[model samples]
Target chain A: MTITVAIDCMGGDHGPAVTVPAALAFVRDTPDASVVLVGQEDVLRKYVGAADLPRVTLRHASQIIGMDESPSLALRNKKDSSMRVAIDLVRHGEADACVSAGNTGALMAISRFVLKMLPGIDRPAICASLPTQSGHTHVLDLGANVDCSPEHLLQFGIMGASLVGAIEHNDRPTVGILNIGEEEIKGNDVVKRAADLLRDSGLNFIGNVEGDGLYKGEAEVVVCDGFVGNVALKTSEGLAQMLAFFLRQEFGRNMLTRLIAVLALPVLKRFKNRLDHRRYNGACLLGLKGIVVKSHGSADAFSYGFAIARAADAVRTGVLARIAERVAQGQTQPEPA
Target chain B: MTITVAIDCMGGDHGPAVTVPAALAFVRDTPDASVVLVGQEDVLRKYVGAADLPRVTLRHASQIIGMDESPSLALRNKKDSSMRVAIDLVRHGEADACVSAGNTGALMAISRFVLKMLPGIDRPAICASLPTQSGHTHVLDLGANVDCSPEHLLQFGIMGASLVGAIEHNDRPTVGILNIGEEEIKGNDVVKRAADLLRDSGLNFIGNVEGDGLYKGEAEVVVCDGFVGNVALKTSEGLAQMLAFFLRQEFGRNMLTRLIAVLALPVLKRFKNRLDHRRYNGACLLGLKGIVVKSHGSADAFSYGFAIARAADAVRTGVLARIAERVAQGQTQPEPA
Candidate 1:
């Protein structure tokens, strides 16, 4: 029942500077959890403070994956890299879960290659938790398999539903296929096929959800292929930033405008955070054999710490075991021919 | 030159309620411009006042295309419909340009079929005026062709550049292709091919632009496939709405926040309008033989008027004719194999 969290200490923009301290904070904050910081020992010590003195085990690794390095090459060449070693620890039962903010492609590939997928899972889906107007919604297949089959989308729905149930505490969370329109006959072949499969499945399929649905909590779980999902997610981020930038420009137009902006500081800050990408930094690589969390590479300490808690919650809820059992039991409802 | 604008009075959510008054106001304000209101006479007169109506003509039509009607079917069945008749006016030299807030798909198809594409133009692109931090950026192929080839994208870039030059007064605006990354070697096959094509073209091609660049004013013209453009545009709209919704929620959370919101009202209003899609509602169907403008279906009177102005601007600049000349001259720059 002991919770051991493996951390990729040399992964993000700040590398060990942010990752090592955050790992120590997580171990200190969570009484029942033990942390294994994966990186070169000499570098890890440089960032860790005296007060944070090696309370956690330091695992040595010779290589560090660059942020822009090719995903496959980084994983293949740097076999003992922090990212791969951390996932490997989870695969060998040395860690309860693995966390990294490295190159998303590398982390996803390494996790899938090392721990493998759960039974009935075609591929590992990346599910990001979005802070919606209503509450929180799970958006999946962010960039795992750019080209996905209807079956893969259906699996995404099931895994997303399961993850939301365990993490967000939404029982039987509604599942939706992202589409250009809500009609059953709307989207492309891929979307139509996914909708058909979802309809047949006994999961609480809520039909199609558009891009707006992701932020308004139109459904608890929104599923799509990696290509569409990646575009949708990045586009949303670009838009939020754009609006914020526009607000700043309008406010700086004149002296009176600057005064007005000062008065609305509190309200604007709240709005900024509500629409902030930083708040939705952590993502879960679901349908895998073990829990593997991925945070935004540019995430600060607060969000990085939150990712640790997210990972711990998933492990405690037995999310992976439940998915494996359901997948192994072959109880998925079949679509009519 | 007579700046006659033919409006499909049957289009839009409110239709004549928004379009008629807007047209009346435009005639009153502009003084020199003329308008031809194409729709059922009864519906048209109900919205437009007979007295003091300066240079306004109402053309009767028997059919109207509903939002849910199939694009091809509407064009075939509703031959003398308001939308069709309006475009016909431009085709037959009775009007300088045409405007419709109707079904976008139908408009693109009908315009291509009726007016025909300019010579040398492989594909016609839809160009929408978008408000950016710097001012306004022209984004094209917003939703005209969902599935596109590298060649089609190259056409979009060329057409978008020409449209921006005519409408925005940029002689040779900076052009950039939308992609996942900015590097020349980055993105899928389609993007790399388009980049090679653009580079050889000797247009002020600025290479690739990421999602974040759309609102940052990285380039005056941002060209993308219809599928990606549609998602990007819709995602931006959804995110802006979501941010505003969340801001209102936060403002109403407490009394102090509400007071702060009131004090910030002036700057907030400016900020809101800066991101208002309505201001940039109209999109020109570029590469066609005649000028055709499409406005948002949900636009109000003010938005409809702005759309009319947009249509007039395109006609005044002879943008369509210039595009046709470029195509006819076979002036396309060859790309490296």
Candidate 2:
């Protein structure tokens, strides 16, 4: 099986400085893997080595989605943008999958517009691989569909379950709906309806998982709408940073505390690495016609490399095909919605 | 001024085992602060001390709200529940304010029912202090009202802004709506509607704030629907646990990494303290006719003490009176259906 990943060269906070080298590193690491660098040839060449440059194909894209541009406008007008072109590579079968650290909204929009939704799939949900206390869990619809129906949430459960299966190697993943509490009749009307649909969907549905359960990794798949999902993802990121900042302040409080910190050095280092976003850099937008993985915007070379590797992993694991099969067979329908 | 805190002794994960000691500790620490422990006399006496318990008062109540009970059902049926009695103390001016580390849904439901909403207030919003990259930011509506209107969010902004004034001492706090992006035009229909309303309402609106910005303390007042706020709060809690787990695993990795960990000890402890929920354990249910505060169920005596302190802060700062004035002055508009 061949895996070719389309890289958006002109994406992210640092652009080609991070994306180009990351792509090269990924290809070098995986000798058999192929990658297409989509951006202006001149800009991309600066980051790639001349000796081994030809190994990575450079696809010219005239348009580039600005960080500030409206997603709908960019998707509609910037048809040949780097992000769109890279997504097109997967749609056209030129690449097995696509990866980008671009505008998340634009990436999601293009993935849906170009690659289209999987058969019988009402919407494509974005699943973020988050590190948790127990291990790791997959959080879905991290800003894909703003409004979701009970059936849509059920579909997310199926897709999230399948994705978690591929990543966590759990044949029947435990699925949970993100809610304030762990009750059958909690949350708003939508969440309540979704819980009912999920419980009867024939999946290994765990009752509702509260916020604390997320880190416990009690459920492999945690499902919610884009708005909530996005909020969850951001809140996690914010808290992580907050903790890091606070830790520094506490350590610096006095000489005695500083010495204690030094004695506990090894433990602290290990802890920081576990919470590092780089370890789980790439997130796959599931239920699309093809694989489209998003890396964090502020990700460095190592993180971007992980995103490329994640795209390759998705292709290797045949996530899209499994989703297609699931959708095609109408196996994703909720028992009752 | 003497501070009297009404504590729901029957509420929490371990009930009186945790709440009783926590209340005693608060009174011991703050000489002027007194506590009214509300619960059945027998259960209250099991945890309450005899000698130094002079500052503490017991208010007997036979009913209790089970954690699994629906918010509406518990609020309606458990009229004499300890949570209700604790809140009633604040309503009747028997206590300056109230604190409960129990079922969140039940607390919100009962608090709103007994305490009532301020004049011109459509709903009472739950505002929690979240650890951010910057010191602190208050994210509101963390499960007060699930189905929120634009006006509800606007009210949240007003209440949250006043909270910043009271706590952070910010003259006119910057308010931001929780969205996937920082742009004014981004987000779903609800966010867009809320943004439009906030912009016109004549507050210190700062457009939309993404999840990542929460820790950055970009906005002193962060507003969202109860559902989104609750998810965000839970996600932060989950992420913190996940990071802590990862750090422990990393610390146990090997000898070489262990050496680096030693040098980074001070920084790590500071980080943990900065993100610790204990530092900001209590959140006010804004727009209530009287002050009501909710504490984390898993709160230790220290955190419960902080909850009592927080309630005192709200009362001393006259937050409810300020909110009543803001609502009456027509600073925020009505929600459009």
Candidate 3:
């Protein structure tokens, strides 16, 4: 029942301050789960004092890759950095998965380089769990590959559906191809071609889902190219922040509005709680041999804990194996030229 | 200088019920402007009784294109349809511009066919004015061509800048190439290539802006290919609607929440008004030799009136000439091979 996750303590905006406390909290909550904190020994000891929890382990990594470091530079030089070493744990069978909140480009590059891709997957896709109206919809290829062909999109769908089925226990999850319009012939050549593949892939392929469908809970797994996925993800974040800013400004405008705000503070709190991005902070890096979940770089201990929990859940549910099996099945059918 | 706009009264989800009343209201408000309502004579007269207004004119057409018809089918068969006849007004110089709330694909195809592309422009991008934190940001290629080259993106920046300059009175609008990350080396080859062209094109290139940048008002003009743009736009709409639904469900959960909702009514009203998508309707079909504006298909009288105003403003400020001139200037500079 033991599931171990390698934690990149030197990643993200807050680095060890956020990741270490989260690692402590996560292992405490999940009794059967343990975390390997990968960072410098001296710095790691500052947070994990007395080693009270037997589930906690500190693995020494010689270097640290910065939050803003270029992927090329980070991959080229920081070979022994926490981000790389943490992912190495999964590759070497020391840990079930690795969780990082570092530079996305660096993490993707290092993970792909060290762990390698699955047999049928050409490139690893960044899969993030996003909240939809009904429940959570797993969206993939967030930003791993900007220019994706139809095959890459098809692979993303396979991985996403597998992850959801294994973790959520949804045997037949609907996969939606994100397009401009819901019609079959609405998108560019790549999307149309991807649609044909998804339709015949034996999965529950729901036709095209438009941009709005991402939030409307039209599908369990929404597949798109990295460029579109990234834009949609970021745009949603930016909009949420803007809405919060506007609310604050409006409440502070005049004495009447301010007094009304006090009366409605409880409802406002409830509303804010419903839309908090942190609640859905954890996203998986799909199509890789090992399970890799990405936490938002700016995530606080609360959100980072969720990310750690997410990685552990994937390991417990055997998502990686499910994806590999599904992928192999998909690859058996010849790809259209 | 009197400006005339040809309105396709039989287009959109609401058809004549929305467009006719919207046109009448627009002419009543704008003294120097008139609208030509294009549709079957009987249907047009049903909405516009007695034709009492001197600023109004009814132009009859032989056919009406359905909303769900394919773009190719609509273009080939419905040549004398209301939508095509309305566009013909601009083509024959009978009206300064055309406004329609038709099928987006059909509208784009017909507009391009009838008006022709501006010199140096390869495609017509759908540009809409989005309300940001400060004022408004103009985004282009909403859903015209799903696949675009680097040169198309470069041209979008040029066209967007000229539109802002002519309409908003800002000579040099800051343009941001939409990408997943703000870094120079973040996006795919297409975006990277587009970034290079934008940086060297002598416009106010403000580097890359992420998805959230669209709402944060980071740039006055945000450029992306049609596929990404459409997804971003629809995702925003979907997110906003979902937020609204969640708010309603929360408020209706119990008596306390409903009481708080009553108290927070004013603030909620103000907040909704600020983020109302209706205030920012009527996206222009840019890069066309003549002007064509597309309103939301399900627009009400108030929003459709705004669409009419948008068209008149474009005609008044000479948006088409400015775009054509700037495009020619950009074309004169040797493109990077």
C-alpha RMSD for every candidate: 2.8, 3.8, 2.8
* Model 2 lDDT at residue A68: 74
Better of 1 and 3 by lDDT: 3
User: Relative to the unseen true structure, what is the C-alpha lDDT of residue A330 in candidate 3, on a scale of 0 to 100?
Assistant: 65
Clashing pairs in 1: none
Q: For candidate 2, report its TM-score.
A: 0.91
Residue B195's C-alpha lDDT in candidate 1?
Answer: 84
* Residue A7 in candidate 3, Cα distance off native in Å: 0.8
What would the per-residue lDDT of candidate 1 be over residues B118-229, giving only the tens digit for each residue?
A: 7777677888877666776788888777667887887887888778777667767899988766656556677788888887775688998877777778888988877667
Candidate number with greatest lDDT: 3
lDDT, candidates in the order shown: 0.82, 0.82, 0.89
Which ranges in model 1 have alpha carbons more than 4 Å from their true place? Answer: A50-55, A250-263, A329-331, A334-337, B183-186, B329-331, B334-337
TM-score of each: 0.94, 0.91, 0.97
lDDT of 2: 0.82
Per-prediction backbone clash count: 0, 15, 0
lDDT of 2 by residue, A115-162 (tens): 888877878788888776666788888888889998899899889877
Candidate 3 residue pairs in clash (backbone atoms < 3 Å): none
Point out the worst 10-residue segment of candidate 1 chain B by lDDT: B328-337
After superposing candidate 2 on the true structure, give the runs of residues whose Cα lies further than 4 Å from its correct spot: A49-54, A167-169, A249-269, A332-337, B49-53, B72-77, B167-169, B249-271, B332-337
